[model samples]
Target: MSEEDVVQYLQNTPGFFERNPALLEELTIPHPVHGGAISLLERQVSLLRKSTAEYRGEFERLVSIARENEAIMKKSRRLILKCLSGDSLDDFAGVVEEVMREDFAVNYMSMVLFTEQPLDTSVRMASWESAEPIIKEMLAQSGCYCGVLSVAESEFLFQSQSDSVMSSAIMPLVSFEGGQVVYHGVLALGSNRLNHFDKEKGSLFLDYLSDLLSALLLRLLP
Candidate 1:
């Protein structure tokens, strides 16, 4: 009989193995690892071992992610508290950069405010008319963007540190004025690692930060 016929027969007659139980121990299969033969029982054990190892690895990975998210939430809470306690926009800007560097290990960061009026803050200020078109395009596409940025885009956001940044995340700070949406500013974060802010990565945390910054800016704006 053909191999298919034999397989069909074995599947159809499950009691065949029980009737001739010796085959469970005597039948040999090719070893997956070393070049040798193993009994059917040994092959089954090997497969079970592999499956168990995979499940264990997946469990550990999930635990690691949970711990990482917990730490991030704690850091985010601290950042919010600091912002709330700030007396001025400059203080807010300084604390944000400090926390990003000290707590998040960010390589480079930029906070840009869109306004024509002179501001005392250390963060860059530009008129909405002079804002880069790419920034507008990015805001149009989504509230947050995470991925590798072009050299020109990096320069506009990161300035002198542009060359060092391999990947970045951008969040637009938006506010409402006279019932109309206003794109007030942007927060850009850069990392040296190529995949630190990969396109596929989730941006929920960044979006939360953006919302906080937008509220702060709206309150502090002159």
Candidate 2:
């Protein structure tokens, strides 16, 4: 029977009145059968109420987790800002390493600042050898602002890296002053699992990291 018809049947069934003595006395119609069907209908209603309660509980837990995560990110961003205020590049690197471990749970992370002249063609930037072209392309494309990129799964750049490394998140750090975009750097992260970074995941923390790095670079730049 259709669900609506079944509901109508359950509500009006004579057997329900017979099974439930309390209900039978209240009803005007006389019920021939004692309480069997009424008992089953009461059980169904109880189960529905229980299932709804469980779903609501789960939703509340999810919201709590999201808020906790947000608080963690805010603390991490504050630490990054403190790092940016340092006078030396070495101090910044140390802070970046610490932040990556605490915030992203990633083992390998690097911050590479670009120069007008190529440093060395042999040394791959941020440990990704084949990504030289990709990096060059991105710098050319974006002109001079902070941007985010996800590496392709099949890309050889990631596959050839250490076995512990599975994925990377690349964000360009840009310094803008008086409507002029001056310095650019890259923040790279390496994780052991392919699913570590993806579009589905929120990148709010990463955006904050990029801003902090950009501010540091602007201060350090000549």
Candidate 3:
């Protein structure tokens, strides 16, 4: 029979290999490497070994992610406790900036709240008229924006450090009251590393950070 006929027959008869077990050992195929003939059984063993290695690599990646998340949880707890312990609202922004810069290794950080009434705090207070357009364009509909920033956006948020920033994670701080969403402000972290804040990275951590800030601001604001 032809080679195609042989292949078809082998496919049709699942028990053919079991019936003639010696064929599996005798059947020789070109080796993937070394350019030599090897038995079908040897080829099967090689494929299984490759698959096992791949599975092991995937398992290690998952374990690394779990460990990273655990570390983040610990740091977040410390931040919460320290903030709550502080006596005045004035220290909130300073605490956040210090922790994020010292522990998290962020290159730059800034917070801006859109309020007509000036507040005595480190956080920048501005009118909604100017910040509205920038906030809308930067964040769009997403709660967090992680990637490179436009020139205007970079200057608006980072100012003097704008030229040094390569990537950023920007979060819109919002509060829900009586089923309506209130856009309070923006929290941003910039890094010199090009891939520090990637677009593909998960934003769940940023979302939690924004929620914490919003809740605290709601309590501290008049």
Candidate 4:
């Protein structure tokens, strides 16, 4: 057969190497890194080594992620305990902000709650009966929204200190009574670092913290 025909036949054939065991070891290929040729057996070994290394790298990445998640969850448990141990809503808010700054390395943290009537707040808070469109839009997001925010949004949340914030997260807070949302709040966290509150970061931990805070606040609120 012609060279083309032979090549085509091999492409269509399965187990051609197994059928021609002698040829498998008899051939040679140019080494990728070295300038010299190597035996077919050595070439196969090299390819296998490369593939094995790739798989090992992937396995290591997965292990690292698992370890990181485990550590976060452990810290989260402690945070939850500290939060729940508070004697009153004000105490709980203090613990929440303190823990967030110390454990999460946050630059700024504030809580904004909407209410029909004014209520005493524990931490830095803004109470509004009717919010601006920008504020309402953020609350309507339903959950955590993170990234570089607009000048208006930053100013609305952070006010005069807005200039220092490079990244921010706004977590919508809701109180459900009889499966209906009754009250809404916004938990805002900011950082000077541009990458601190990135959209790419997972929000599972944030959601957990917000859920705990919302539930606690709801119990104390009307």
lDDT of each: 0.87, 0.60, 0.85, 0.78
After superposition, the stretches of candidate 1 with alpha carbons farther than 4 Å from their true spots are 1-9, 12-22, 176-180
Q: Model 3, range 1-222, lDDT digits (tens) per residue?
A: 899999999899999999999989989999998989999999999999999999999999999999999999888887887777775567777788888998788999988888888777767877878887766777675678899998889989888999999999998878878997778788889999999999788788988988887777677777
The pairs that clash in candidate 4 are none
Better of 3 and 4 by lDDT: 3
Please provide TM-scores, in order, for all candidate models, with all chains considered together.
0.83, 0.59, 0.88, 0.83
Per-residue alpha-carbon lDDT of candidate 1 for residues 16-60, written as tens digits (9 for 90 to 100): 989998879999988987969999999999999999999999999
Location of the lowest summed lDDT over 10 successive residues in candidate 4 = 122-131
lDDT of 3 at 143: 72
Q: Identify the runs in model 4 with alpha carbons over 4 angstroms from their true place.
A: 4-20, 32-36, 124-127, 177-183
CA deviation > 4 Å runs, candidate 2: 1-44, 117-132, 136-163, 177-183
At residue 152, give the lDDT of candidate 4: 88
Question: Quick one: best lDDT, which candidate?
Answer: 1
Error of 2 at 166 (Å): 0.8
RMSD of 1: 2.8
- For residue 220, what is the lDDT in candidate 4? 62
Q: Top TM-score: which candidate number?
A: 3
Q: Candidate 1 — worst ten consecutive residues by lDDT sum?
A: 134-143
Pairs that collide in candidate 2 are 16-38, 18-33, 18-34, 18-35, 19-34, 19-35, 19-36, 20-35
